[model samples]
Target: MRRRNLTLAALAAGGTLAMLPGAAAWSAEGSYPDKPLRLIVGFAPGGGADALTRIIAEGLSKQLGQQVIVENRPGADGVLAAQATSSAKPDGYTLLMGTNTAMVAAPTLRPTPPYDPFKAFTPISSAGQFSMFLVVPASLPAKSVNELLAMVAAKPGAYNSASSNSASELAMLQLLGERKVVNARYKGDMQAMTDLLGGQIHMMFTTGTLAPGFVKEGRIRALATLLPQRSALLPDVPTGGELGLGKLTITPWAGFFGPPGLPQAITDKLSQELQNTLKRPDVHAQLVQQGFEGYGMSPVKFAEFFRAQYEAFGATVRQHNVKFE
Candidate 1:
């Protein structure tokens, strides 16, 4: 299904497992999650995937009697985590926090992608959808996307941008394609963020899940959202279009996904619980604080969204001729 073979190393660091395969396993356990479940995320602790998964994991743990533990497997632009989820037992006990980075951009940017995202996993529910943000060091001379574009253009390779995931990579590809800047790579956004805070890298496009906290700390300032409309979280920040970079608009999303061949019973159960999780007041407030919102849709609806996103990202990939380095 992809140009490259997908191999996800099993980093089983103390988590519960679903019933082992066999027709009798279901009959042996009348209820789902007789044991705890593992929710896999593909980034380090401070990045978008890790942050969002932890929030959802807490809510799911309470809703289900067993704990839904989150495990980090950060690498290869989320291919590592997606591959782990794909190789997991499909009994619904193992799941992935499928983000645009992991599910869409990783595959789009690579030939022989680690896995065919749609084929390797079953869509559970849409977790969260959001616009991207152009984040720059507070010390950067530019305060808007237009100004940054000009700044980089004038200096050429004098400035460098950071990229950890495909969303940021996609943004950098477009920005660099036009203005030509250096891209300093990292295994995770948090790593890149480390440099951004220290002014080692000048700027990046980050998820709403990550940008606000740093911005509030004044370590970095979000110059603009990738969308044409203003963000609910950073109301004062203008959109790229508003800043005269209309070509920069891009909104990436994330969702819940389980290993392929997950039973309908388990899928429905988890989807319902995720919907409930999104509605919790505390969860909602925290998500809002980080610039994320609830996404409620049945597994069927989520599959539709998945297909649409798959098509959209494929177009972007082809248009830009993006590829793994």
Candidate 2:
């Protein structure tokens, strides 16, 4: 009778274990992404974010032996795509090709951002960084950032600045520097570039891709890059720090993030594959042609970099009192 009782007790415990939730499906190395994965981009097709995501996704697909699709959910400075990513299951099937604007600036620019940048996601690897430059109409005589600022200081509100985005707004505010400069806001880059080219707006902050082509064609001039160090992509243009404008630095980056709670194993695997993909000569050359330098970081390192950047951008955002309307 005692032996029978012991047998029944053991069977009961075994049955309970078998019936417990996820007990049958709790492998740490469970086959992940048996199906195709989705990479969400917060911009329209053919734009920088979309193009970059597709490039990375193509390589990722080859590495993983499964298709990694690029899906565009463009809106709200990447807020829509971020919301989608934050709400996805942490199973590593859905990922975000997030940008500095989507992750860092979104929270600061809006009263209630869709998702918290630091909490809602897990940083994987940084894709690349884009360099921003101070651009002026070709007709302007200011040959350097210092010369241009001196000109703005003298004329004050006489010269107008075309602020195409929030980052540009903050940098332009710093450029104003205890002085007056009329800030003309625009919803997109092309609109502002039109006015600058038409001689209506005298100065603007632009990215490497847009500024260099125009500067080379003699339509506009690049005074200084917003980076602290000069970009190899445009060696002739001095850095803002080198030009004594260190306070106006803005180094925008593109990176990957999975929803919070993503398995560490999956994150590690993805990060490794991504680093390998970025190092490929073909991939590196293509990204460089798109005005990007491949910058891949491991999960832990990317988290540290993300937090540091958050602190830096927060300080700048607070100082500028920048808000989107």
Candidate 3:
């Protein structure tokens, strides 16, 4: 009888031990994000990417019952922020507001390739897309895309154009196509826009979210946009296609990503909340005004989409014969 009792107790203890991992996992998942979370952005504060990210962060904060702070780690066309996120603890506390520039363009453009998009991070959900606007200083003599090209043709390297990310750089390259224009690289759009406003640079590919207000205020001149249709927010601005500069078009997108090895439960929780946040009527309205289209997808769907985009960007780079300098 004593032996049987001891055997029963040992079995019970073993059972509890067997359940601990699962129970601990459940507890972790259930009480997740007890503290504030950090959402990294690769752009300076007050720029289009930063502004749009803040909006989503606010929505996420409300949904998760914690602060979702936007921490800017701007540099290397968003690669710095992405690298930080990829190397962070896989606790779901640190996330990246990744852009096409970081995920597709910057890496593809670089000679060494910082990190593999497939292995560096786990895709959470897509944030949205932006319209690229060809903007110049209001004081610039050129009034249209054609005039800008003519100016570049007439005076080889007299004008310097700024680019903060690969999408912008590629668009400018395609537009100029062997025309000698000095390339001024910036860590973020706001800094580049500042230079343009100060006459440090003559022109740049600014985003729709950042351009409309400045253009309306006559602070900058918008020559064209890379949108399929004229942005409703900037209805007066024509698209690159309309200007017969269709090759200048490029699609810029943003999304959320977690450090690799993030727990599945945490991933699902964040993804569902993000999708909800994007669907909010208030959120949708504000995003539209900022020249963004809110988008969301499940982890699996976004992963597939990310892979497809990576390949497409590679093809674009090869086709353009773009070389890293």
Best by TM-score: 2
Q: Taking the tens digit of each residue's C-alpha lDDT, what string does model 2 give over 101-141?
A: 88888886677766678889999988877667788998999
Q: How many clashes show up in model 1?
A: 3
Candidate 2 wrongly placed segments (more than 4 Å)? 1-33
Predict model 3's lDDT versus the native. 0.86
TM-score of each: 0.71, 0.86, 0.70
Alpha-carbon RMSD, each predicted model: 11.3, 4.8, 5.3
The candidate, 2 or 3, that scores higher on TM-score is 2
Q: Whose lDDT is higher: candidate 1's or candidate 3's? A: 3
lDDT computed for candidate 1: 0.77
Model 3, residue 56: C-alpha shift (Å):
1.6
Which ten residues in a row are the worst by lDDT in model 2? Answer: 21-30
lDDT of 3 by residue, 1-325 (tens): 9999999999898678758756645656889989999999998998778988999999889889999989999888788999999999999899999988789987788888899888999999988778778999989989999999999999998989999777787778878987889888897788999999999999899877678889999999998887767887778889888888756535677899999998888998899999999998888888897889787999999998788777766766787686766
**Model 3 residue 222 CA deviation in Å:** 4.2
- Writing each residue's lDDT as its tens digit, candidate 1 over 1-325 gives 3423232212231112343454334443457878989999888898655777788789888888789999999887788988899988899889988788778876766667777877889999988766578899989988767688788889878988888756667666665566777787787677888888999889888767678888888889998787546778778888766656644433567789999988877888889989998888878777776667666679999998888767766766778766667
Taken over the whole model, the C-alpha lDDT of each candidate is 0.77, 0.81, 0.86
- Colliding pairs, model 3: none
Poorest lDDT segment (10 consecutive residues) of candidate 1 = 7-16
